[model samples]
Target chain A: MHIDTGSWHRYMALPAFLLFSLFFLFPLMQGAVLSFTDWDGFSTPSFIGFQNFVDFLHDARALQDVRTTVLFALGSAPLLNLCGLALALLLNKKFRGKQVVRALLYLPAVISPMIMGSIWYLLLQPKRGLFALLLQRVGVSGQGNWMLSSNLALVIIVLVNVWQYAGMTMVIYLAGLQAIPLEHYEAADIEGASSSQTFRHIVFPQLIPSLKINIITNIIGSLSVFEAILALTDGGPGYDTESLSIYILRMCYGNKTGYSTAVALMLFLIILIPVFISLRFFNKVEER
Target chain B: MKPNTTIVADARKTRLSPRNRLDWYLLAIVVLISCVAIIPFYLLVLLALKSPIGGLAAIRLMPDFHFVNFITAWQRSALGKAMFNSLVMTAGGVGLLVFLSSMAGYTIARFPGKLNRTIFTILLLCMMIPGIINTVPLYTLLIRLKGINTYWAMICVMAVNAMPFAIFLYSSFIRAMPVSLEESAIIDGCSWFEAFWRITFPLIGPVTSSVVILQGLGMWNNYAQAVFFLQDKAHRNIPLSISLFFQQYGADWPLMAAAAFLGLLPAVAAFLVFQRYFVEGITAGALKG
Candidate 1:
């Protein structure tokens, strides 16, 4: 098994490597080059290095999108981890109908973002939507146009994102929770450690790795928000819910492919900064 | 809950243990959170079955006995054919991914070399390229290859885009496995490829299933790239079709609700049927990350 011919070795890795280079790497390089040029779809792209990015920087809507993207990522990721941790703690214990509850929580995630957003679009449609109708059933006015309001739109988008994804973090934390050694808790108990003391001393530190994983992923996913926001608000009520991805899509439709690519590169860089920092910081903690 | 087998029972044995309690408070919290999570899905089905009088004016918990909305969505959206396209795309894409990456992963794990290591690292880095960034370039590449609007184009891209994580999972699982099984097979006059096919491949069942569910669900729910590549209405996937349906029926809330449910049906059904694999796969992927 150890003595493999050079031909077979190449054979084993050829398909994946070929596919990756052609589909993933080549396109990325193309995007990189495209970012520096001016092309409006049909016309030939002319070299305009740094100009597209310069324009993007000067663009107020693009800047607002960056702000919105950052806010969404910041608001959603932390709350996702917190709610997930709480749910994980709650579900970690043996309980009746545990699987049913877990499946229910995860159901939202399985639904496509477009569908989820559309459902919420109906539910939050101010006057005669599900929420309003339900509220009216209880004799409370659901009169406010939820998605039409700029301030509430971004908040709703972020909340809907958090709602869909918290279950994933919960499942992660549950896995981390179960892997905790039973003897550690027994030892803490024998030492007469109180409930909060047991959790603080024995559980919290151990779940840090899980928390780190959830945070990084939630950050990446939320920052890439597009379909849901598109379906829900279409960045409407005036750019309040316009994320970077949605901004890029809208630009592409406006025949500003080069600029959109430049914007995408910026968004990509913005997403990476925190992910790398969190990963490095957490790896250090894990080592300790 | 178990008579003598659970941590709960053990906790109950400790007189002053906080875990000794029935944890009703925790259960209530879990139930409430689950309700919040599930209400949209619940309402999706409920409203789909019932007719709306005036742009979603009616709201009821009980599902009406009618599925006229379903028929309307299906016919108006041409969803049946579109769903077929999506199913084919997912199967072909995920199948290609699992097969190719598993072989590559096994090779990488079994054979230790600088080339393989560099390749794996490079593959991991490829994912950092935000997906939207690749849209235009990939489209250009597809056009150059005369691959635009073809099923294979989408399938290949899906397989390749998702290959990094599939390789990650496969290689990780393969690394954790003992080499003795493959070694014995090779010693019995089986070729290395034959040994992998017969032995090594069979042993990596959990990770393989994980790859299937993760990538399968991903492709099923994928909409953005499909919108970019599959421009023809004849070739649109389920998510795209549903989105199109909603746009056409912008004011028809009940029909839109039905379309959304129909689009979500495949993924939701997959999750329910393979709930165990989905949970295990997600948990394992998270931990590995």
Candidate 2:
């Protein structure tokens, strides 16, 4: 194997660049071009000249979907972060069975959200579901299927998502917590600082960086939630739980490809705006 | 101390005492929360074992004591076939992802040239782009390319999705490694590719394992992409099989539960077998960088 460094570098980079081009870049460019036209996906796309964008702008239903998507993201992201932080705090203390608890909590994060949705669907079924039956046994009668009602459907979806994803956030936070010097906490205690005072001054101050990445990533991910929403609600009960991803999916796959492309582009911008802001925010924090 | 200040200090000390009854109360509350988390999973296991027809009628806080449902679900759903398909796809996808990602990573880390940095930045930016934006176009493109109802379509998508993260991890790990190893190998007349294979690759065993396990579990349990791509029932993967199991046996809670449990096997097994790597893989970039 008479090998040279320079030429080998070229060979190494070649396959990866080609792969990315074929699989990633080309389709993205094609998607951008197609977004401008009316294509049913099967037929040749006719030039529509911003008609899709105009149609998307006027679509009240799409606007509502945007609201619902934001609601889901806002509600779930904070709750997940809090739950993760709380768990990390508790688990950071020396305890028996800590490893087992960590493993169990992280289990749901590894499973696909689609599978989790399916499992929860069966478990949360109103009439014959386990929760329903259990509620009956407890003498607390409930009226409607949780998944059927618009308000409850949104809440349940967010709660299930939090449960599934909180573990990963917890792991990240725990790592952050570990990075904090133990001596800092000790010094705070020596200064007669109360637990809450120590948390505010020492723990929370140090958590800013983790919060920056965790909150931004989780919110971006929360807005783009599609698999679980599709499997569980299918944006049903009249588009109550219809996220932008689901909205775009219905447009792209179900009925209107052109209109959906516009909506998808909007969803991209919505995701991008917050992410850009968050990145800037994080940079500012780092610089400080 | 003065009488008034002494009274206030005594009250504060009582409140702040670590061994107070309030501490026990808080512990109880936390234990209660943990129980709530555990009980549902316990019930799921019990539900999976009960007889379908007898299960709902016999629903209780505890197991109904029927284990045959597992056998029936396994027999009826062709779970074995689905598992085989999932394993094949995961193995193929992770295998290619590791090799390709590490090569690019090594070049970027070692060379650090303008082109490499620009490409790396592009990748890092692409990492933030939502996968949904790519889906509609990717699906249509696949259909046009006649890749529907095929594993290749699913494999390609999963591999590409895993690429950015894999490269990110590999780049960080390679950069952490001393360049002295590569330089030494170069002096021994080994080429860059050969040096990477013999030296750099060996050193990255832990990270490589992490990538394999993390991506492997993800691909194993992946259903959304598979559902869209694999139109045939016989060709559907594990998660889809579990989903179809629900649709078919909606009333049969035991069978559906059993099938879901079976569907969780590979993911559970992967997590257990490579638990350390899984944790490292997840917490690496977020925590360290």
Candidate 3:
């Protein structure tokens, strides 16, 4: 192939670059600058260095939201991986109704998170909740009040997120698992290796790529839990479930765009520390 | 004694959970888990069709199959209109992405230089940063350009959101393609665009499918971005309309369920049509990131 380096080669990338700059580049840079200002999203902005950051530090609710956000994210990552991996393993088999089952499991995933959250909100309400009513049938009281309880609210958010996304990870993991040659497993069987032994030596190692992808993406997704939380609880039960993403929205709607941007930037920075750690960890493992 | 040993070994092999070989117990468990997965959606559908008294509060699983609940929520929220708007946006956005990304990918594959490296690197970085972080300034930028609440604003936003992944998918696929195809065409007096369109474009089936599946679903089901940019009632998509309907029918679970599932109808229909590409798309999208 005699490919020439013509001017049109560069010009071919123009549309992508144009879109990237107009929407992503311009806004991100503008946000960075505005984070150091005192703009209320409307009137002409005034320069106020570090004031937004200072406000983020002093604002107790934002700090609390960060705490709740961490709790939600920390809860979400491991649970999603476990559930997703489990479901993937289960569905990987050649069962009779496998296709139907896989579709059902992914049903929650396809529905809008807003709808899923609201559906769950209804299903978890105290007196009227389906789960609550089921519990009562099994010798408990009325609804369990999962959504209203501060302690349970954050936990519920994690569960709801997992419910909505575990199918995605399961499908991803299924793809990974399918790629592993069956001969390896047959070899393990011929060698008289136990099931757990096979998993430890072969299956787990082969799945690390999928694991890294799921974990990194889930970690980021957990930190940015917004729409579902907003729909589910609205940061209710006294802000026990407010994540930084949700908190920043509250700030934005409160007409403090600069302050919210600063907080969001901080959230991004906080997210980076974990992202970098995981990337390094992933690299080191893959090196082995 | 030998038969007993074989049975013992078989038991050990199927003894574990989650990764267990199938047994009666394990199959039952799988069925139960599948039911757990379906129950919420099942309940949503049943409740959506039930009369007002047979809402979530009732312990019964059956619905009277009333279309009135669907009708009430459907008419009030302008479900059809919002669905049409979402469909148009998704189609437009996905179409634009397929065209531009194929070109970018072609460029990256053929031109292995600093510009390619830089563009690819920046895209990789951009994938990590959520656009929500720039909402304040982005909102202001849209306002300044009179793009707030406009169709162009959302179509462009959705397209841009889908860009990084599209570029990555395309570039990787194109790089792996046989270089001779494009080379032979260009040698035969075809211009770059001409060679790309006739020869190279036909071969990008895999990535184009991924772009369509992933970006199309993304634009269709998105609520957060829509909530931020398309705030006006008339300009909103299905998810936003669903949210409004939820708010309006605060304590009305039957109505809420009906409206919610109605909002999900389009995306679900699309997924059914493109079910094959979806799992493929998710796997590709995740593994690359």
In order, candidate lDDTs are 0.82, 0.78, 0.81
Q: Count the backbone clashes (under 3 Å) in each candidate.
A: 0, 1, 0
* Model 1 docking grade: medium
State the displacement of the C-alpha of residue A165, model 3, in Å, after optimal TM-score superposition. 1.3
Displacement of residue B194 (Cα, Å) in model 2 is 1.2
Per-residue alpha-carbon lDDT of candidate 3 for residues B2-39, written as tens digits (9 for 90 to 100): 99999999876654332434668768978898888878
Off by over 4 Å in 3: A1-5, A142-144, B1-21, B53-59
Candidate 3 backbone collisions, by pair: none
lDDT of 1 at A126: 79
Score chain B of each candidate by TM-score: 0.90, 0.85, 0.89
**Candidate 1: misplaced stretches above 4 Å?**
A1-7, B1-12, B15-17, B52-58
Interface DockQ per candidate:
0.62, 0.41, 0.52
Candidate 1 chain A worst ten-residue window by lDDT:
A1-10
Model 2: CAPRI class: acceptable
Q: Candidate 2 residues B1-289, lDDT tens each?
A: 6999999998866544432233555566557756766666676787786655554747766676677888898999889988888888888888878878889888888878777887788778777777677767878888888888777777777787777777888888888889888878889888888889999999998778777876777788776577777778666888888888777887777788788888876787778787877887766657544
Candidate numbers sorted by TM-score from highest down: 1, 3, 2
Q: Name the DockQ score for candidate 3.
A: 0.52
Candidate 3, residues A1-288, lDDT tens digits: the string is 555636676567677978888998888887788888888877888999998898888989989988988888888889889999998988877667788888778767777788778888877777766677777878888545666787788888888898888888898888889888877877787787887898889888989999988888888778888888988898988877778988776676677887888898998997877988998998999999
